[model samples]
Target: MDIKEKIRNFIESNLIVFEDEAVFTDDDNIFQMGFVNSLFAMKLLGYIEQEFGITVANEDLDIANFSTLNSIVRLIGKHKQEV
Candidate 1:
C-alpha cells in the first residue's frame, strides 16, 4: 500500500531466509538486519533500478540513500523528479 509496506513485501518475497517476525521499521538498520550482505545489496540495487526505472551510480551506492525504506523512497522521488 505505502512505501514501507512495499519495501517490506519486496524484501520478504525476495529473501528466502527472511522471517516475517523480524522487526523491520523505518529506522531499522537494514545492514544489521542479518540477511543483507554485499551480494544481497547489489541484488536490491538491481531491483530498485528495475522497479523505479532509475540508474543508481557507484557514488550513489552509499548508505545515505539506501539506509532505510523512507530514505530510499526519498531518493527515488528525487531521482524521478530529475528524470
Candidate 2:
C-alpha cells in the first residue's frame, strides 16, 4: 500500500477517534479532527517508530510536521530514505 494508506490504517488501528470510516487527506487537520491530541500524538510517534523503523528526534515532535496525513507521509518518506 501507499504512504497515505499506511498512515490511515495506522491511525485507524491505534487511535480511537480515527475509525475505519474516518476520512483523511494530506491537508486534513489531525488536530482539528480531534484525531490527535498531545497525549495521542506521543503514541503516534511511538507507532511511527515501530511501524516505519525510524527514530524521531525530540525536537522533531511538532504538530506542523504531523498535522495531516500528507505531511506525515512526507515525513515518513524522509525517514525511510534515511533508514
Candidate 3:
C-alpha cells in the first residue's frame, strides 16, 4: 500500500471511534478530534520509523507533526528524504 494508506490503516486500527464513527480526511486533526490518545503518538512514531526505515529524531517529536494524516505523511516524507 501507499504511504498515506499505510498510515491511514495504522491510525484506523488504533482509533477510539467505532468503524462507523471513524470519519476523517487526511487534513483532519485526529488527535484534536479525540480519535486517538497521546499514547498512540508513540505507537505512530515507532510505526513510521520502522515501516518507512526512517529515524525520528528528538527534535522531530512535535505533536503537530503527528496530529493529522497529512501532517504525518509530510513528516515521513521529510524524514525519508533525510535517509
The best candidate in terms of TM-score:
3
Q: Could you give me the TM-score of model 1 versus the true structure?
A: 0.78
In candidate 1, what are the lDDT values of residues 16-35, reduced to their tens digit?
45476556777666766764
What lDDT does the true structure give each of the candidates? 0.72, 0.77, 0.93
> For every model shown, what is its TM-score relative to the native structure?
0.78, 0.78, 0.96
| Candidate 1 residue spans exceeding 4 A from truth | 16-20
As a TM-score, model 2 comes out at: 0.78
Q: lDDT tens string, model 2, 7-78?
A: 787776666563755666769887788766777787778878898899987777778778788888888888
**Candidate 2 off by > 4 Å:** 14-21
Clashing pairs in 2: 26-70
- Clash count for candidate 2 is 1
For candidate 3, the per-residue lDDT at 36 reads 97
For 56-79, candidate 3 gives per-residue lDDT tens digits of: 989989999999999999999998
RMSD of 1: 2.1
Which residue pairs show backbone clashes in model 1? none
Q: Give the Cα RMSD of candidate 3.
A: 0.7
What are the candidates' C-alpha RMSDs?
A: 2.1, 2.3, 0.7
Clashes of each: 0, 1, 0
User: Measured by TM-score, how close is model 3 to the native structure?
Assistant: 0.96
